[model samples]
Target: MSKLWLNSDKNESVFIKLFQIINNKYPNYASQWLNSLKDFGKDWEDEISNNISKVFGPEYNDRWEEAATGYAEFCTEALRAQVFFEKHGYYKASSYSDIVKECYHDADYMKVRYLPGQYLSHYIWPHHQKMLRHFVRELIPKIICEVSIFYEVGVGCGMYSQRSLQMMPKAYGVGYDISDYALEFTFNVIKKHNLQERYEIKNQDIISSPIEKKADFIISQEVLEHLEDPQNFINGLYNATRPGGWGYITAAINAGHTDHIFLYRNPEEVRTQIEKAGWSIYDEQIESNYMEKPIELRPTIVGYLARR
Candidate 1:
């Protein structure tokens, strides 16, 4: 295998091992991806590596190869979706029911492939890493109020809620998701961290059954593009947040994935939608997957720290 992309002294064995597994399975693309990550600084790499180890325990050792395969397969599927989007100007999956039937209801696909791949992408994918950084550094720190209660909408891999509980030790998290697999994964994650007492997972859809009690902090990441009516979803988020509360919401723009339904053309479209929902954008970041692309074709992530 090629030399590790991250610093040798960092003791990032879990991360390096995952990379090796990917390289062994896919030599060419893995090598190119690792090479591209050489410029990713040590501090950022170290932080992500540590978070990965914390979130995934010894079970990851046995499943590293499976996770690596999942990552590769997921990327392949995403690329195919992106190509289709470029050709047709929309995501392949159009309806919430279709996504629920095809992606969310498939237990093997969610547990063994999509969820694991998405968990790794939080650390490996450059744009995802940027969004994670924004969540940890920019969004989390800006919440000056005491976060007694927080809500994590669409708790996919449960990383964001786990991070929130970690950062705000006194805060309790209520995670809502429509997918049973997602709730299960999130439960296991928080249980692994011994945060089960501080966090709770509910198999509920906030879009349909909005939280009756408002929270001081709410975070919904990469969920906007998954919904058919994101404006209403945004309004629900706003309603679920207490006055003077803080929210961190993220959406994908011109980015295609197997289950992504609604298409966001640009960051301003997302910003306007959030503003229309009565959120005052406090801080925001837009990170593109590519350094340069036609304005309409760029795959980007837009994250906002908003006040209710």
Candidate 2:
């Protein structure tokens, strides 16, 4: 619904009239600023994007119709607001905080699960659980133990550590990230899950986060590429793994992700480095990063079971 295309003619006409009213009412206002906002056209209103296709039938290209309908709504609001502002002068408001205010927002880590793709946290969480079960069985198979301690890098929305804690009893997890927004989102998820006792959220660049002690099992999933220098972090993680201990790592290989400033691109890079740091690669799997690209190109992501 938020992705709808809009009606050009109608939006243009509406904009023209709105501009006229603004110009008439506020002759000295910033036209350039207003012009820059012109790109919003009419789609600023996301309400109609979903229904436009169904209501307009096949001829009305739902994209354009939804866009047009949404713009119609926004244009009206803009007109009213602009006129009111021109008459009433200015209202005082502070700028948004540097960090995102996602605490009140929704996620599975917290009590609510409104975050799309979160309730269905099928990506890394499942694999983390699988690896934990495998590692724990090897560690203390007799007791129905949980992977109670976990550290997740690039903890986007905090699902990785959250799921780990859910699967393990008396568990404690930490989600570390640099972005204030990412941390805020992670914290919100943590709060929602009422996991304050077992889980800790921190805003730290994974590459720089100080590790004094080795973890029972380190869980790093799909987080290597974004660092300025991932090699040091990789080596440090290896050094942090205790002998007979496990660290399950995952990375995308030969993929072009924009946020990915660095690319693990090869599972060998991870495997080789971990081995040098005294960890042996127990098992490695090549999964379709895209499931469509040629096998080599789709080298997409690789999961390595590294034991020190």
Candidate 3:
């Protein structure tokens, strides 16, 4: 493995150690992926590494291995979905129940691989990395008033809520998700961050039972595409947010995964849906996978910062 990405002598750091693990596991692909991130500079890599080390402590290496494994599995599933989409012009699965059975309810897969892989992707994948930076640097700083409470819908690995609480030191958070494994993973993450007192996890589906207690801020990242009715979900987000409250919602457009059900063709469709749900868009970010395919077939992600 190359040390070109490291800024200091902390070669045994979680970030450097994970890079070595990835190189050992998938040398060719890892080389290309690491090279793609070279332009981001060592400071970017150090921040991510330090964050992971702080969050996971001694178990960072173990978690990083799981993330690398999960990333490989995720990529394989994505490639298969891409092939299916190319031939069919749509995502493979439509029913939410099927995904629940195959993905959310699968304890072994969700806990050991899928969720960890997803957690890792937030720092590794360029698009996800950009989204995280946008949320931390651009979105959170926009809230001028002191945040008392916030909600994260479908808090996969709980990184967003954890990061939010870190920034808003006095704020409390509630995370809602249907998957027990996801909730468990999030609970561990919160505990890791020593935020057990400030964060609460609930095994509830917001789409079925919208949260009655409105929050000062709400976040639903990459969750819109998983539901059968994203519009209803967005409405639920709107209702859960107090008037003049802020929201950060995001979705995958033309992106295929085993669990992704709803297919968004473009960013406009997503922007229109959020606007219909009564969120006044303050700012937005759209990133494509940069595949050579046409716009409709390319994988894309769209995020919004809105005021309800």
Candidate 4:
């Protein structure tokens, strides 16, 4: 295999630490799994490291060594999910159905599977940060150049909301999610960033809860597939957005995560759902940054902006 980003001393250290931890917990899988990332070439290697730095901010250098422990758990969960896929095939359950709903809203499930720090550090920071960074640069300004009120659904750890609030000096934010852990995490983040006056976190289900007021801009990331009814969620988004307002929305396709129940075959399917929700798609992006384990096929993150 060609040289990978992991070949670098810094990146290698993180991976090695993660592997050692994983090996100690579950032997033999770490080395084999880490090797799968090697063939992705230098580009992916750079993307991963750069995005991680961007996500963790100035403190990343200080904490990354310790953060590997969380990443190990995250990787282990992904491995377990992959094993489920290999054994039972792609998990296909209707979004918002009883089974998937219980997985998302149940206290035990949320604690064990949806812990915000572990989820953000292990998955979003390492894997999806590039996509988010891309949004802040390319999508955010293009969609909502300036807004007084910003709303977000599935505010996982509040990174997106915090960043958006920071970037837009005049804007205040309101975010909604089902997880108590996520709400608490977001609350702490807003305080840590001295943005307490600028944001509030509500532990509300966006689909069923009243929006309170229409927003000048809205955002929801990595949330659609977990819903039992994504189209209804989209319509709710449309209802929450004010006329002439546009927002960023994201979903993953063929991503076999522990909680992802909806199976979107392609970006087109996502787009079709958005249009069906009575919104117009203005801009869109799709990228599969990592390949499936033991197979080269990548699961994609599809992003789009819908205008009200």
Candidate 5:
């Protein structure tokens, strides 16, 4: 059923037609899923269409509708999982080092999950990107007034680096990541934004390879949960930032996804780790899933701006 929508060769105009067919075929699932899109209003179609075109170009006709539906499906599935966990209170837990080791051993996991069109179509465009956009927007004043040299760790698609460089003309940035695919994706994103002059990226381990020069600001969004030694990672962010500089870091709280290994059950765990690294939280945002009955039943994506 997901394959039908994901591979369908239809564009935005055929959304209603596909919805009708889906409603007829899977009446129960379609009702809830279709209703979810209503939250975006009448212009949701256009908004998603433009996003699809912008992210994948006009040739990715199959992607436009899936980006919208897939997101709703993800929300529904996440909500279901959350409810199950809340009801049973049984959960799987693993050591951070073990999960980090598994991720390093299976490098392809990051590539297939991110690498531009993949995650952008499947997860980010639908689920995480808007929250990130809003987060960055709210911090725009800080970006413009305070930032100079920005360092981004695990810059998956370079969206944050691109936006930061765009918003701050005087700011130059360097991005570090362990994956070649991520580096390539960041390269393309920088190229797409015509920001070749403002950014430089390196394919290196951010934790092991010491940052030779300290930066005024740093961003490590959604990357902490992937590592085993988050304390060390936080310390690395601290080392990367000069004294009085700022850093924005984020991680998932009870958000169980395919590659999400480090499950911080509470956002305070993240704050404690950052504070241990000698940073103070300036602002925080915790976004909850929309379809959850109690809202708190769903996993929360947490972000924080910390100053050294």
Candidate 6:
């Protein structure tokens, strides 16, 4: 029962191909798989990009078809899993029932994503490089002289971090994330820009990071929507910042987008959460798609400035 790749009316071969590579040789179910792709189309294009980011992602410019094919492979894997489980009466089902738990193995859903996704934000929005400059110039106060530390959590590929460093010229940062692959990607980007002499970053779960450094400021842009645990992340933010230190968190609110677990219908909810976690809003701003500035939320961006 090999998986078969399904194509939409538009010849877009959804994620079924990727699943096929991992599951069986080919994929099965034409209509069902096509429907899933249709369902996924309900999401905005940006959401679609984020959902399969590990595939086509950001860096690769002209490879969306390839990513879609990869996604098909992933879907086939799901089908194979379901068929295998049904045939062998594989322990019925459980809370964590996405993997093959036949005899003695815990190899579940870490199958793909070993290479980490390309930078979706910076890639989709080339002006994000300029936007980073805007943030640095707007936030970095004319303060005491020294190589200041600008911390960026969830620093995907260090693009923003590098841009910020370029704007300030004497500042470095600790780009933090939960994935070593992401950290490595950022490291490579930083090295390409030759900023390693100043920056010190690591692949760490911000929610559980033990190392504490009181940053002068922190920036987390376009990352909150993906967080499944916003509260703990807020607490982690509190712990990461020094007294009177500040943060810039930009997110997509209320928009039914991709990987959006903690929905923010409005900016106040995020502000409220941060306040509840013992932080205060130094300032906050909202940008709808109508604005000309890059920071303007085109259907999903919400930006906040808070103090800890």
Query: How well does model 2 score by local distance difference test?
Result: 0.48
Task: List model 4 lDDT by residue over 1-308, tens digit each.
Answer: 22432354544533444444445664644544355345444554454444345443433353453344445555566657655655666754444556445655565545444443343442333346557667777877774555899998988767788778777878889989877767776777677667889888888876778686989898988888877678888888888898888778889876666777777777888999888988888888876744544332346788887787
Which candidate would rank higher by lDDT, 2 or 5?
Answer: 5
Candidate 4 residue runs with Cα over 4 Å from true position: 1-67, 86-89, 92-113, 116-127, 292-297
Angstrom error at residue 5, model 1? 5.4
Q: Tell me the lDDT of model 3 at 158.
A: 87
> Tens-digit lDDT track for model 3 on 50-111?
66776555455566777667767766777789889878988899999989999999998897
CA lDDT, every model vs. true structure: 0.83, 0.48, 0.83, 0.66, 0.65, 0.53
lDDT of 1 by residue, 264-298 (tens): 99899999999999999989899887657786888
TM-score of 5: 0.72
Output the worst ten-in-a-row residue range by lDDT, candidate 6: 95-104
In angstroms, how far off is 243's CA in candidate 2? 4.0
Q: Show the lowest summed lDDT stretch of 10 residues, model 2.
A: 91-100
Off by over 4 Å in 5: 1-51, 60-113, 116-130, 290-297
Q: List the residue pairs that clash in candidate 3.
A: none
Q: lDDT-based ranking, best first?
A: 3, 1, 4, 5, 6, 2
| Model 3, global lDDT | 0.83
Report the candidate with higher lDDT, 3 versus 4.
3
Residue 22, candidate 4: how far off, in angstroms?
A: 7.9
RMSD of 4: 5.2
Clashing pairs in 4: 95-228, 96-227, 96-228
Candidates 1 and 5, the one with greater TM-score: 1
Comparing 2 with 4 on lDDT, the higher-scoring candidate is: 4
TM-score for each prediction? 0.92, 0.53, 0.92, 0.74, 0.72, 0.56
**What is candidate 4's CA lDDT for residue 300?**
74
Instruction: Report the Cα lDDT for residue 67, model 2.
Output: 31
**Candidate 1 lowest-lDDT run of ten:** 4-13
Native-structure RMSD, model 3: 2.3
lDDT of prediction 5: 0.65
**Off by more than 4 A, model 3:** 1-10, 54-64, 144-146
